[model samples]
Each structure stands twice: as structure tokens, then as C-alpha cells.
Target: MRRKKQIFLSLGIAIVLLAVTWWVDLWRNTEATIQVLAARCDIPAGSRIEADHLALISIPASLNRAGYLENQELAIGRWTTGFLAEGEFITTNRLHDRARGLSYPDAALGRRLITLKLEPAAANGFWLAAGNHIDLFLIPHSQDRESEMLILEQIRIMAVLDENTGHRLTDTHLATTTGRLICLDLNVEQAGLILGRLGSHDIRMAVVNENPTG
Candidate 1:
């Protein structure tokens, strides 16, 4: 009888120990969380990180080691290297400097940023912004005999320069005028072709695509 009683005591202790362990695990899963910032909305690549786009989130500590940003201040004003979705954790590896905007052309290998001059009338009527693709048309000096032939197929506009100064213009107010310049992201040979013809040929722009690039 004593042996049976000892067996029951051991079984009871085992049950209690299992229950305690289960409870401890459940509590830890709920309580052990790491605080981090995540994208509150879809953030486009190359966009400067804004406070409204971020949200504070608490995720399990074990998963947080996967590389999540903890400080909100550190993320603001930094340009995103790629598109990040909502609820996605902002990692340290995907940010770039806004002041150093050189990475825009780095997306396309072997492409160099070059400035191209076009008459406001030939261009997109002073409405072009960055990421716009335009086909180049060459208008000869004599208008009587020849037609304007397409010189280039599709050249991506990297940026639009200010009307007076050479500063980069934002899409919000790409403020266009007659002499506004456009920065192109093209291959070395293509850049050379355009640069050589700028003074001689009457180059014009025909908008192919106006979508914003990330």
C-alpha cells in the first residue's frame, strides 16, 4: 500500500511540474517582446523615410534578431534603397543618404548620369519629372524636305534641373521654364552621342512613360 501511495505522489508531482512548465512557456511567449518600428504604409524605394510612415510594434524577441530597426529617429530622413511593405520591419541594411543622391543611377549598371538640354517646346511642355522616359527626335535645321526622325528609343530622365540654378527639382514643383535642363541616366556611349549632338542637332523629347521610379 505504501508503494502504491508513493507512486501516486510521484505522478501528482509530475503533473504539477508539467503544468508549471506550460504556464511559464505561455507567459514568456506573451511577455518577451522586442520593441521596433515597422512601415505603417507602403513605402516606395528612394523615398525619404517619414515619421507618419512608421509605426511602433512589439514582436517576439527571438524574431527581432532577424534585423529590425528599434529607433524611430534613426529611420527618418533616410532614403529607402528598396520598396518596403506595410507592417514590414525596417532593417538597418536598406537605407541610403539623402544628401548623396548618387545611388539613383546605381540601380542601372553601366549607366552614368548626364545633363541634356532640350527646348521647352520640344520637351514635355515643361511638365516632365524624374523617372520619366522620353524618346529623342532630331529636327533638322531645314524644315522643307526631311521629317523629324527618332534619334533614340527610350532614354530615362534621372532628374530635372532648376530653371535658373542647376539644383535638382522635386516632383512637387518641378517648376519648368524654357531653358530648364534634364539630367539623363544613360550608358557612356549614349551619353557621348547626346553630348556631341547638343550643340549641332535640334534634339527634342517625346514622352514615352511618365511613371515614377523607385
Candidate 2:
């Protein structure tokens, strides 16, 4: 009976030890380092990232397990969707398609989304999207002036519209391709300035944030 008791105790101890080892191994695996691509320099939003600007690094997988760039090819030929400091791991949300562009949230800090309708020649061939910084050029359609004047600069495009069809592109879809009006996000004072210039000056949308490489 004593031998039987000893055997049962040994079995219980072994089971406990096995369970403890499994837990430790699971913890270690979760904390394991994963290979990912990171920016080597300060890559600004809208800049086309290349291999020279990237480096493969091993990092704690669980630290930022979500949205990590898993391959070098994924990093190449993609635009930085937002500002990326040096040595920052490239994530899915941090990159964008080269043809398509980035869009931002609703304007904050005492700003409103102001919708402004401009001619096709004025709105940059319908390539406008949210988060695009634009400058409005007022070419005097009247007899007052022969030269072009800068009426508005650094205006943020909050939304776009298909003026003919009246569709609002909130998320920048195929709907924006037919978009004509580039909505501006601005303060009360700024809104007054843009609206006041409409009659005499024909406003044109120039994307100031177009790829610097180009």
C-alpha cells in the first residue's frame, strides 16, 4: 500500500511539472521575435519608399503584432500613408497604394468641412481626395486683371463630390473619380475668405502634397 501511494504521488508531481513546462513554453513562443520591415529614415507621408529607406529587423512579435509588414516586397513601391520616423516598423495602415492616396479624418480644432464647387480644369483632373493639401489659384475672369493670383493656400480637402451627380465621397471610392467639388476643411474666418473670392477669381485645385520625388 505504501508503494502504491508513492507511485501516485510521483505521477501527480510529474503531471504538475508537465503543465508548468507547457505554460512556460507558450509564454516564450508568444514573446518570440518576428522578422519585419522598418523604415531606416524619416519617411514623410506621400513619399515613395524604397529599399534604401528600409531595413529588415527582428522585433518582439507581441510588442506590435498587428499590421506589421511581413515582406520586403510589400514595403517597396508603396507610399507612406502617414509620417514615419526612423527605425519604425512598417505596418499595413502606414502604407498606401501608389496610384491611390491617403485620406484623413474629419477636421478638428474649430474647423468645418466646407464644400466648394470648382470647374474640372480647376480641381486637378478629379484626382483629389481627403487629406490633400491644395492651393486655390484665382485667374480673374473679369477685365480687372490679366495675371493669376493666389487666393487660398494650404487648404485641406476634407471630402470630394461628384458635382454633376451629387455623390459625396466620404471614403474615396470610385465615386470620387466622378468627383468635381473638392470640399475644404477650414475655420470660420478661412471659410469666409474662400467664399468671398468666388465671383471674380476662378479657383483651381493644385495638390501641394503631390509626391516630392516627382
Candidate 3:
């Protein structure tokens, strides 16, 4: 009976010692360092990045020696770092930070702003939006004579405001009823030419299909 008790005590002591050793190893292993990306390295947009560009990400001590470690791959935007959400992969090809060419002429000071009113029959079904390029069609007539049509291509649509209230088209729901006042990015002289020709004939809008690279 005494021998049996001694054997049980020995087994319990061995189990305790094993548990302590495991706990120490677990604490030590919790100090692992992981790789994380940082954005302060002057990484410019459209610059390709690789794993080497990342900085080390440190795990908390509490999680270090848990016998399980997870390594994740991350793609971060330029000048950014950290674990990205799932399916959020970043690349240079997808970044479009460059200024659009259509908005260029208006960047100058003292630029002329011209409002062109479009009736439903004239405004291309009122399907125009800001930032769209259009070709202007004008019907011209000599006094008491049949009118001729003139086509001006490559005009820009600045805004589609409301004609009745003279307010900008703010609500999409009021679009069909508000009537459209189209702002054309034209020079003072050009605007005058188009406005003078408005009623003599008819005005129409056409979409301008420009090259994407241009």
C-alpha cells in the first residue's frame, strides 16, 4: 500500500514539473516578430512594392509563446502599412491619382462660365452628367430663311443646373422636372457665339468619345 502511494506521488510531481517547463517555453516563444509594411519610406503612388519593402511587425508578449503563430500576406497602398482587410490587395496599376484633362481649362483664373439651357428635345434625353464631354449642335437660320445646322465637337459639360429655380441640380429625384441649365467650359467669345445661335435654329448635345490615354 505504501509503495502504491509513492508511485502516485511521483507521477503527480512529474506532471507538475512538465507543466512548468511548458509554461516557460510558451512565455519565451511569445516574443516573435512579424513583418508589417510602413508608409513613411517615401513610397510614391504607382511604385511597385514587394515583400522586402515591409518592416517587421511585433506581436504582443501575451500572444508570443502560444505554440501557434500565424503569418499573413498583406498588400498596402502607397505610403500606407499594416494588415489589410480580406480581398483588399493594393497595386500601382489601380491607382489613378492624376488630374483629369477635362477639368484643366477651368483651373485658370478668370475663366468664362457659360450656361446653356437644354430643353428635353435638345439635351439628348437629359442624360448628361458633369465631367462629360459633348459635341454641340446648333441650328442656324437667316431671317425668314430655312436654318442650317452647325456641329461643334469636344465641348465639356461643367454642371447641369436647374432652369426654373436657377439652382444647381442637387437632387437626382427632381432631375426630369427641374429642367437643365448646362454649364459649358467655353471662352467668353466662344460662349457668345453659341448663345447667339441658340434660338435661330435648334441646339442639341452629343457625347464626345475621347481617347482614354489622352
Among the numbered candidates, top TM-score falls to 1
Off by over 4 Å in 3: 1-107, 142-147, 170-175, 210-214
- lDDT by residue (60-137, candidate 2, tens digit) is 777764768868998788888788999888888888777344444576866756787765666776665777888867
Give the TM-score of each candidate.
Answer: 0.48, 0.42, 0.42
Per-residue alpha-carbon lDDT of candidate 3 for residues 1-214, written as tens digits (9 for 90 to 100): 9999999999999999999999999977866554333332444333444455444445454543433213324343233322333333233333333422233344356456788777776776667677778988886657445656677777877777777786666443333755678888876676777878766767788877657798
Please report how far candidate 3 places residue 28 from its true position, in Å: 53
Q: Which stretches of candidate 1 lie over 4 Å from their true place?
A: 1-21, 99-189, 192-214
- Candidate 3 to native Cα RMSD, angstroms: 13.3
What stretches of model 2 exceed 4 Å from their correct place?
1-105, 143-148, 164-167, 170-179, 210-214
TM-score of model 1 (CA atoms): 0.48
Q: What overall lDDT goes with each candidate model?
A: 0.77, 0.75, 0.60
Query: Which ranking of candidates, highest lDDT first?
Result: 1, 2, 3
What ordering of candidates by TM-score runs from best to worst?
Answer: 1, 3, 2
Candidate 2 TM-score, true structure as reference: 0.42
**How much does candidate 3 score in TM-score?**
0.42
Best by lDDT: 1
Residue-level lDDT of model 1, residues 32-72, one tens digit each, is 78789999999877789989999999887888776888998
Clashes of 3: 4
